[model samples]
Target: MTGTGLDDERAYLRECRAAIRRMAEGARLNVVIGERVAGDRYSAERLGYDLRSLAKELDEQPDGPPFFGRLDFGPGSAEHHGQRYYIGRRHVSGGPGRAPMVIDWRAPVSATFYRASARDPRGVSVRRRFGWSREPVALTGFEDEHLEAGQDLGVASRIVAAEIERPRVGPMRDIVATIQPEQDELVRAGLEGSICVQGAPGTGKTAVGLHRAAYLLYTHRQRLARGGVLILGPNQAFLGYVSAVLPALGEVDVEQTTVDRLLARGPLQGDDGEAAAAVKHDVRMAEVLRRALYRRVTAPPGPITVPDGSYRWRVGQEEFGAIVTAALREATPYGVGRERVLSRIVAVLLRRAEARGRSASAAWRRGMTRALSAHVDAVWPATQPEEVLAELLGDPASLAGAADGILTPGEQSAILWARPPRSFRSARWSAADAVLLDEVSGLLERPRGYGHIVVDEAQDLSAMQCRAVARRSEHGSITVLGDLAQGTTPWAARGWREHLSHLGKPEAELIALTTGFRVPAAVVTLANRLLEVLTVDVPRTRSFRADGRLRIRETSDLGPATVAAVRDALGHEGSIALIAADATLGPLAATLRAEGIEVATLDDIASAARVTAVPAAMAKGLEYDHVVVAEPAEIVEAEPRGLNRLYVVLTRAVSRLDVLHTRPLPAWLAPPAGVQG
Candidate 1:
């Protein structure tokens, strides 16, 4: 390309930026005018909210380009004949009488930009990719692939490589400009379809999931907005890491939360063994809870009597017991059945009055129903989730009744509290208990469902947890995202089929993304060695960028070596993470701080320090530019499926990785010095 060509592209970029500014300004004015012309208080309030949301969407990001690629179409195309279209994150139009200055990447016409190639032009004549600096305000360079005959398409795009290799800073950014053909297929997948992405580490599965959410919002805005879209991550740290991606794509309404937060019950206190927690999280626990809850509906202790004005209605113990038994046989939830039982008792009294030649008014029946409430309350009480779960864990008789033929005596005892608390308020609940409470809460009352849910790190969710998440989206669809190889929990899913069935999305289409764009080739290659030991058969991922450097250091003084590694990593341009075993994170963070190094723990959400000390377990869905692993052996020994955890720790690096270990690396990871595995 010559100077004239460069100048022409620069001028076109400037023109496009001006158009975007005008479009944003016009949108702001429309919202302001709408707010002023509101007819009532409700309309005004709604207009204000819409205005705030529009302002967020139209807000200019200083470090982001309005458009990334431009396509020139030949004559006789479906839309825009012999016209040029700029594909960008958000749509921008020229004033009223002019054509659109930029087309949204999610638009049908712009699909050619991402899908077209020399092999298949798809009506596109030329594709141009503009390169920008980190700030993305000015066009630094341009690359064009001409599809006309006798014209070279040029070598592979340096701009694409540069964008993929961009240094990591802050949270993950939108991959709008650099979305691969495979990723675009998933992103453009219809809103009604549920896709389960089984991607290897660094394969950009999380990004693909978020982008799909944004795309569906764009395509089915009103439907999804009414039902709502939710993104479920593993923890707060992971949620905070990817929170910015959707906003950057002009989608601000998608809810991003964790399973525990979404369940919204209990403080996650108390403890349970792995075996006990697994048993509680089993799908069979749903039936056990059902038995425990309905057990509260026993036969009436005595006859019921009600007084209305000068008349009294009496129901014998046998009749009342028969009514309760019939109501319980309805198989409805306890809360719902209790009301039916009470209504039936009132009906029996009303029928008796009619048979004796006495008339009962509507008001008289209402009065009788209220007067009989005390007897019904004593027989079939209204129970809360926490109250029932507490009884199930504390009382031996209730446990045995609910667990009979379902759980062994040892398994039942494992879940029972050694010293039962007096009440629900005094009881401590663990993470697993929160899931059980969610299950019971759903049974008592129908849970509200979202329009769509994106479950990230889904393999780590237990069967009960999946049920809880599925209940919230029972009427909608789901996007399940995770790699089985990265599963670290005891109840991690062995297969996507079993997992999706628990999520109530058994027919969801499964998509595998085997090409990695985040982690470098060398890092993923080293991590893939663990696949030999693990039973999972994940495909080897291909990296887009050059191989990153991997250095292994041997040191007797672990603290000093880790600190030195952190200092060395700080010299890089992007974020640095020092990963160690959970037990070692506290002391290692303290040691780093004591050495005058500013370090932030992963749990500290408020801190944005460049150097963060992350535990191996919490580092599942996160990535950093430079990573320092303190000890490989400790991470492998941390849990039963520790090899999976170590694989996750090793692949977190995007630019470089330094492995500092005082102890010998696990034999599976590090073979004999002279012999290669």
Candidate 2:
């Protein structure tokens, strides 16, 4: 098996598949094939015969008939129609090189199978004859099959299926099974009203999302042949990253994008959507309000409050600027009164909404009008009337448009949110495409112009953000994924469901992806250990032990013992990562660098490095070889923001772990004290 040739490999594969098929039949076991891009690879050999038996299945049949010799395109063939083509319901022609193409397994004449043309290969055409359709069935007995593989007069043969089956398994595995689940389950769940999967970090949230897409395509191949779903990835990198998952699962590719990309298409895309002028108008209003709030808050007698109570405070006015300059000169790490004033304005609008029979948004607009009228009367003594009103309610659209060209780097900070991209609009504004927002918790705002909504990483989203997501989709299902322990968003509060009432979503459908499939039991153990919250004054440590089997190793060092622990972990195989809470990034990075150890910032590592040090904040959505929590105490006491971050960092370690820290470890992190090696 070491260097088997292709034909030999094929024979071995055939034999193995036959054996697995027999085992599956005997056990009434369903097979879930993993990593199935090509049909040539073997089934399994490691992780014990029983576990491997359940790991995957390799079908002897090619992706299609054998006559075509596997029609899969080579890497990078997605462009030029060499590979990847979209098959819409009515034969939509041509798309990105990465789009999916339809392959017909059933044809009256094997050679007459139709494929969408490379460039508008509009109609079906006969290609070549395939062989497998005419081949006769080959049958064999289970004992004979096992004997052919030739186990020498073996010791009592292992009860490959019987002895290995565990009736009651950990809940996490159940979740993983459901997340991607078996194909039949996928078919059943796909058409079911709505589905929700709340996956924590390392829980394969994105993986399940991709699988779900494929499942829909495979089960409902006819309906999905046309565009039936939309995928919203977190960003472009993510779009490219998870693109292959669906195709691997035999799914027709659907649309994928970011929220900004979707918004561009929502109301701004066509005649049916909002006209560009109206969009521009809103842009202007946003700017006018921004400037009005800036000026109103910086006036001589402190800040000004409008009748409805919306107020503004300037961050860089001359007097306050001077105080900040003095403080910076004194190297003050802490500053006071940096409250975002416009948010207060929004809150005031909410308060006024309760007073008047109007929505908060409507009341806020009325309040702004009243505030401008009052500002005109008071400020007219010193300024011209036109200038006063103009400054108070500046033209935001013109300002925003101009920002595209003339604004300086510092002044153009808001430009990123200025406008939506154009491709996201529906051809018909009312079409409720099944919408999926991957890593939904991180979206900046609820996407506009969607009829239905689905979200992943719900736990990481703040309550307010979730509400925003709910507001964007009208009369559509909202599916979310999250893990309570991996709540990395600094602003996110636990129990995001509490805000579901505000968003108008049902609370009963909340789903949890509790399976620990991506990370081993050891990694989960380490993360849960550091994250064990106290209930009724008792440490919730026992909750960490999901199933006692550790597919991966777990390691740790209490506070004040990290440096030595780091030194020891460094001596092991594989790279290391040191995750910290504060500005300790640069210093510890430099320190580790001085020791000739590889160290990198979390942002940098997020983009490239496999094993490197990083701050907890930057380590979200990523993992590492051996992760070291530099200051668990700092995370617990001074920076609660880092607690979720620490959870993310610890889960990165697949085979090993090293949680280093200073000061005594918190009750959540203390190893069973003396119960050690």
Candidate 3:
């Protein structure tokens, strides 16, 4: 293509941008005159919100282009035959009843843009990928792949390759332009089914999960809107890093949160040892909580008596027992069971009144319901989740009764509170305890459910955490994303089978994206050395990015070496991250600043500094173009799962990894073993 061709592509882009502006303008002009438009104030507010949401989607993207690729359909295709369509993150149309100027990448017709090949063109004549000037996006170039002979799938377009190998900066960006065919398959999978993507670093599993969420919302808008969609990340930082992906794809209704924040039911002023936390997060704890909660409900101790119409009616313990038994059988949450108990007792008294010719009106029922409150409380004492959890954790007697035959003696002691608080209000709880409270809350009162949940870094989720995620997805499905080999928590899943079983989605399809385009082949090979030692059986990932640089520097001074590496890394394009043990990060940051180098903390993704200092514990879901692993031994020795932690740290680099080790570098991995550079 010549300069004229480039100019033509730019013109098309301009048209698409203009179309979006007009659509937004039309939305802005749409006025809902309160009751006149929607008949009610609530409906009118809803109408206003919808209009604002639509307008926001069409607003200008300061730095990004509206569309990234284009597809020309063959004459043999369906309605779209012999037509050219621009593919973008969101749909942009001229007006009502008008064809879209830019079709959403999630649309069915746009699937060929990602999946077309010579062997299986899917009626695509030409697939074109656009290259943009990074950041404040401007069309720089474009490449075309005309499928005529054989599948050139193995040969990637230069534009796609450049986009894949492009330097990563700030927060993680949507990889819509370079989403591989394998990833697209997982992304476009049916919303009815859950998929567990077990992929190594740089496989774009996180992006696939986010895009799948956006796609599901686009395909099944009304269905998902009722139950809603949620994206759960390992930490708030991770959530922040990937927060823009969904909104960039024109989705704002979907929720992004952490498991801790989602399951926060306690004061959470407490801390727990890893062993204690592991015990609390065990699946057995669910049974323990259930038992503790239900034990308060028992057979009626005495007769139930109520006074009505100058007459007294008395019911025996035996008769009350029958009603209680039936109520227990039908009761789901504790509150429902209590209500049923009250209703049955009230019904018996009301039946006697009706036989005497007294009406069973609404007033009569309300009076009976209130009159039987004391008896109902006696039969089944009303309890809060905190009350149940506090008693179980603080009282040895309660713990023994609930955990009998469920948790071992050692496990019981591990979770036992040494000094109990005076009451539930004064109780201090750990994250594990908070999760337990959430479980108790579910058993007490049913929580709301979501249409779909995407849990990233799922391998680190404990049995109890999986259950929390599962409860939100009873009516919906889930998209589980993680690398089992990277599981670094004390209670991390040994395999996806166990993880999925805990999530209550044992039937979900498990997909592995072993071919990566983000991390370099050289970096992957070096990281693979640690995989052999992992308890789980994980396949080594192949990286199409064959040009990653790996440098090993063993220096006597750890701080000085890391500072030097960051200095050199600053000379490169894209973001640089210096990741090491959590304990060493403080001194390292101070040393870097002392040496006249400005260091950005991992939390500040938007920081202008070229280099960011990261702790290995916080590097699970982050990536950088240039990464400096300060000391492999320090990262591996900081925790019980240090080797896994080091694996995560080593794989954070997409373009370059410099291992600055004062001590040994994992002992097994030879220096510069697979350094392509």
Candidate 4:
């Protein structure tokens, strides 16, 4: 903490930065160099690609310092004796004696920096955390804890506390520099199995998921780089919020998308009622769709006879029926089973020809198989998934037969399209219909799975949506992240067991993040009150932070009061979000702009403004340092599951929350005072 110490740390930081720049220069100068590269296009192309990727990975962010912490080891120890390593977002080398100047945070040696304590130093003598300013990015100060000297500062280090309390103005930043011990465990967990995180708001569940992705990519780059990893968020806006996390960690291959976009079968021109959509998303619909698709395979019409050059091959109806029955019993994919039926039927004739001492060449077999196609198509008709789904929903007979005992008459009636289109290609598909079409598509042919998938806001996924995600991850592992209390959809899973069961990973470990460092005590308490009236069994979060402020004001005129609150919030040093119901958000934005306040929207995260007017529905998976909630009563009255929506709206504040209302506040909020009626 002295001036001399600051000067020494700054000098080391400058050296590390210079090493990074040199590494970047090396990657750029030596892109593609190999013997035989001139003749072999494949090798030249691959080397070119690998070099470009390397250069891009070495590119550091312009905001923060390369390394955030330094670890000094005790002498005569085993692994890191008499050595010190600066832990950073990326590796920096080319130091004196060809040593490492900065080690990547995902490396195995950096575990001690996060795991060591006074009781068990793990051979670590001291851990030093550096504080830096982004403007020109200079080393401002440093905090050190000497474990060998038995000096424990507090529950959290001063530098970490400062980082958590920093203002939020742009997109969500990565938590690499401030990851806690408990979160570090999850981030370093093995990549063989799946993990379900039941994290409350501000518990950093999303960040934990993203960091775990980076860790897996760092640890198992070769295994994962083949099939690739995927990240699924609730919406595009939420995706944009956390889009920069992996790239900042030197990972750029992971994909981020939504469930709706993943299962987009056709243009979404029609919509189903909530009841109808819920029924379509039920687990039993999987069986219903299967039954409707396989209805095309039935008993063989008659026997078949085929003629070749100077030979006639005949197959009996009994044998043909047995082949069809065997293919049906195989229970493979629809296309595979159909091909199995064709192969078996053709082989019977080939064997009979061989038994007669006849030579069947390759050309003869091809001709015979082609000739038998018309006969095979008659019994096992070729069908498309869209045509099957359209017919099943359009024709009452097909629906009743497929849903005879699986679905009730009322449930069957709910999903039937009232106005069926003339052609299957021209059908108006809803989002739910797209999921069903995806289900049928899988039944027709199994989908290719990814290497790993991290799905956020998973509590809001329905059974059908979970099934779709499961298919994409059938051959890989998954990291499921969600808060049960924040589930706002009508069909949201009330429990993790049912949700994981539908996702085909029922044995996945379910971990709860009960201690939060993101949301403050006041906001956690307010959100917990709403959890009581609802149906979540997860425990309330205990915020590790001590300084989350809450303010409530009642005024007859919401416009002036909201404008006044925004003006007051502008005095703070972070982003301000004025969240209200959909009906009130536009008028409130007008009021703020009419008063010469620059107000943007929450959906557009890149909008250049300090104050953003966010509708309560779109407030989930987002946070602001300061928040003003205008008319809590209206947020709870705008939707069917409004109280759940209100819970999501109340917990988005990271530093402070302001509630301004003209109507009475919800009784479930449990304010110290009674409602302002």
Candidate 5:
């Protein structure tokens, strides 16, 4: 009914499937790539099997519609520089033994027939009988998001109106829990524009996002392999938490990465010596500042109050003026502390600028700031004044020394840093892809590339962090998932809805998962009081038990309190996790274990063990039977930063939860029925 004739369609399908088979075989052969095969002729000798045999086997499949196989190699080939090669195949996830080297595979559908329909079969009459068609018609316009979704739903999935649906594909209600009728409808609403999902805790933001990704893959199968999809998570720990969810929905393994790793490896690793030196110097400067700030020196008000109250500090005008005067006067016969002054002055000025607004143009700000800094060296001790430069000059020696942590000695020696490389090493780029940074919000400073950026904690990301992610996307699609009310990141300021207007974000769709999946209705009561802080709808239900498990205690020592909580969980044969605000808490965990409480540290729990406890933030996507929230009181302060951490901890528990504290709970932590023990 669809094509010219039955024989013609069959013949056409045969040829198309044959080509796919040939491609698959070629991919499986593992012909040495790179310069060896980059431009070399693909003669029969280079190929392991006869093209005719490979094509014939694919055409002999008994299925109603043939399947397709897809493979990819590292950057090298003349065609795509790490391109995907497709062929019709019978199975997906072919065992490691069957096809150890192959990348991925999918089944064939209407698109395959349509694209192959036009080509001349030559002696292969099946293709000639069907007649000729250019590319796969159905898959032409679909983006990466659509293609990935389509694949998950099924190779036969299609786009009806804007939504991608596969009637044949089964729903994942068992693993995913209840399916919100609204969620299915939301994903199907497929607008040509972008959609931002505004959700609350346990609202299935992640579930919906993944379903959409699968729908896209299934509906747009042809381009799905190439359309890179990126998922950006909160941090490395969170990245690992949700890594397997995509495969569960039948979508391709979307390349996952964090914004920080992207920036560090992408553009930050400069091409030339000068660029490398500049980057290295900036890194050193940042490190030095971090160390000094850790010292927490409380000096007198020398004209300007030291900037505080945020991530970065700002210097005052008075302090700036004083430093320059001293540098100049000290430069007289005796050498002046110009270098120290330069560092201190720059630090103070940046701190002040970061705090409050300065009445000046961007250019004027840079000029004035640079002028003041430069003058310090000019009026100093020696006859020849030292020069103060605002930006670091990328010097190779300095870069080599600075790169000790990131690069190996052999790598440093092999790659010439005197000047930029005309052609970048494919290995370097490929190697850099391994480290995934989920707390993408932390690395919002600049852009690099995220094959596909899926922002898991959207509401927890600030405007600056969003902008940073936008810059990082080189040629991939971005997927963001979050509930605005669940925001606990210091950087997440404005509402998640504001992201559209602020970032000029693409057409975003709003999907509300009305059902609460993680917590029971009784447990929901505690978080309901804090729901006032969020703008999204958070329905309460008695889904989980309110075991009078939450307790606030006032103990003189946090260590003993943590020990007591651990002892309590272990007494019940329950797994216990002790979490702190940051890595600084690493020591706290160690000290507690020293007290002979069966405590688990972050590193110990992060591995393969299932019954282990982790920090609230680190435990973002993970769920446990018994969660002992350590230092909830410390995180419950009215301070914006503290509130975010507190929120993160409160929402982490699944069935049983205990809030341990060294002091009385903060009023901010208490909701309607938050009991004190």
Candidate 6:
């Protein structure tokens, strides 16, 4: 490229940036003016909020390129044919009369930048990618792939490779600049139907899910903003890791949280065995809770007697019992049905007042109904989720009655609290117990649902947990992202079908992302050994980069070996993670600290840190440029599906993986060094 061409590109970029700054300034002025001349308090507050959001959308990041790619379309193809469109994270307009300075990547016109290729140009004449410095101020270089010249382009784009191979420093960056055509399809998938993505490590599943949320929010802003979108990850650590992707992509309203946090009931205490937890998480538990809660609405002890003015209105026990039974049988929420039952009692009192030849005023009848509070309390008590769960777990007799056909005696016993608290307020609930409580709460009262939900790492969510999440999306859609082979939890999903079914999204389209872009070919090849043991059929993933290194080091001193590995990985360009069993994190961190090495744990948000010691269990949705696995054997022995855990640990590396093990590696991972098949 000539110097004049480079200078022209630089000049154009500056013009775009300037236009964005002007738009942001206009947004700020609108906020100020709207705040001062508001019609009312509510209007003022609403205008302030909307303008602030607009300003945020137009906010420029010093360290991010204003635009990453540009597409020049041919004549008669688009409304802006013969014009170039700069694709960016958000839309930036010059003014009402002038054309948009930059188009959001989610825009339909900008789709050509990602979907166009040498074979299928989609009427695109030229596609250009801009390379920026770390600070992203200067336009260092630009690469142009001309589609109209009939040039035979290669299989891969150098620009895309450079962007993908960029050394990431902070939390997971948005992949807007390097989204592949296949990924672009999923990201632009409509908001009407849910999508289930089964992607291997380095397949960009998490990134795709987040980007899809951004796209949905962009396309259906008013609809989604009203009900809102939610991104559910495995844990807070994972949530924190991917927190910036949406914001970076010009979306700031989506809620990111974990299943535990979403269910939000108890201080997660106590533990249950895998079997026990699975049993409790069974969908049948919903039925059991229903029976237990409805059982409380038994036959009224006696007829209700209401004294009105000078008359005593007496209703027979048979009539009251029949109404209570019919109300209980109604397919409605407990609270809703209870209200109907109260109305029925009111009707009975009104009829009795009419029969006594005494005219009762509306106010008088209401008073007579209110006077039957004692009777109503005894018949249909207001039951809370916690109170119902406590009684179900505390009273063995009640448990048996509810779980007769639903759960075996052993299963019931397993779920029963050993030392049941005196009340729901004092109950100590486990994570699984919290899920059960959420179920009962939903049954008693319909929980609020989101417009859309993105459930990353969905494979690890149990049936009941999925149901809890599904309840929140009952009227909306979801994006389910996970790799069945990476399911480390004991109750991990058996397949996408099972998971989708449990999530009440059986119609969701299952999309498989088999290309590994982050993990190197060698690392992915090494990790796929665990697939033989996993029952589900997971597609083999191919990596874009074949230069990733994988080495297994057998050492006597594992801690020192880990320290040495971390020291060596620090010499690399990207983030380094030292993954170990949960029990080994404390000692390993202490060892590294003793060695004068600054180490951050997974729980700590350490995006800037060059090195982090992450527990093997928490490494599911996280990635690193260089990963050092300390004692793979320990990770494999840590849980029931530890081999799957090992696979997850090994595939977290984007560039290199160093397996430092003092014990023998799992036999399924690889054969003995000297042995042949």
Q: Point to the candidate with the largest lDDT.
A: 4
- Candidate that beats the other on lDDT, 2 or 6, i.e. the better one: 6
* lDDT (CA) per prediction: 0.84, 0.40, 0.85, 0.86, 0.44, 0.84
- Tens digits of per-residue lDDT, candidate 4, 1-677, equal 12237877778877877888888778777774532354678877777888878876776445468899888888634888878888999888965588788899999998878888888788877788888777677788888888877865544787898888788878899988888878899899888899999999999999999999999999999999887899999998788888888888888888889999889966898889988998998989999999998888888888888878666777889988999898888888898888888888778888887888878799878888898888888878788888999999999899999999999999999999898899999898989998999999998899878989999999999999999999999888999999888888888888999899889899899999998788888778778888788887888899988887888777899999999989988998999999999899999999999999999885666678999888888888988999999898898888778888888988899998988888877667646553232
lDDT of 3: 0.85
Question: Per-residue lDDT for 1-677 in model 6, tens only?
Answer: 12237888888877877887888889989988989999999999988999999887776444468789888877536675677888888777868898888899999988888888767777777788888777636788878788766542432767678778777676888999988889999999999999999999998999999999999998999998778999999998888889888888877888889998888775877688777788888889988988998888868899888776576778899998888888877878889888888888888877766787868788886786688767887988988998998899899999999889789888888888888887888777888888999999988889988999999999999889999998899999999999999887778887788789999999999999999888887777777777888777899888888677787878899888888888888888988888989888779888998998888877667445688989898888888888888887788889989888888888888888888877877676654353221
Q: Report the Cα RMSD per candidate.
A: 3.4, 21.6, 2.1, 2.3, 20.3, 2.8
RMSD, candidate 1, Å: 3.4
- Model 5 score (lDDT): 0.44
Residue 583 of model 1, lDDT score: 85
Q: Model 4 off-target regions past 4 Å?
A: 1-4, 32-39, 59-63, 95-97, 603-605, 673-677
Query: How many Å off is the CA of 133 in candidate 5?
Result: 50
Q: What TM-score number comes out for model 5?
A: 0.47
Ordered list by TM-score, greatest first: 3, 4, 6, 1, 5, 2
Where is model 1 poorest over a 10-residue stretch in terms of lDDT?
A: 147-156
Q: TM-scores of all models?
A: 0.91, 0.44, 0.96, 0.96, 0.47, 0.94
Off by over 4 Å in 2: 1-9, 12-188, 199-203, 220-244, 247-454, 471-478, 488-493, 499-504, 529-576, 600-609, 637-641, 673-677
In lDDT terms, how accurate is model 1? 0.84
User: Where does candidate 1 clash, by residue pair?
Assistant: none
Candidate 1 TM-score, C-alpha based: 0.91
Task: Pick the winner on TM-score between candidates 3 and 5.
Answer: 3
How do the residues 317-381 of candidate 2 rate in per-residue lDDT, one tens digit apiece?
Answer: 34433432343344211111112223333444466556666555665566664554443234212
lDDT tens per residue, model 3, 1-677: 12237889888788877877787778777744332578777888888888877766666454477788887777656876778888988787857787788888999988888888888877777777788886577899877766644535433677878888888977888988888788889999998998999999989999999999999999999999789999999998798889888888888898899999998864578999877898998899999999999999888889988887788778889998888788778758889888887887887888888898987899988988888899889889999999999999999999999999998888899888999999988998889998899899989888899999999999999999998888899899999999988999998887898889889899999989898789998889888888888788889988988787898877899888887788888888998888888888889989999999988886675679987888889999998999988878888889999888888999999999898877766556667544421
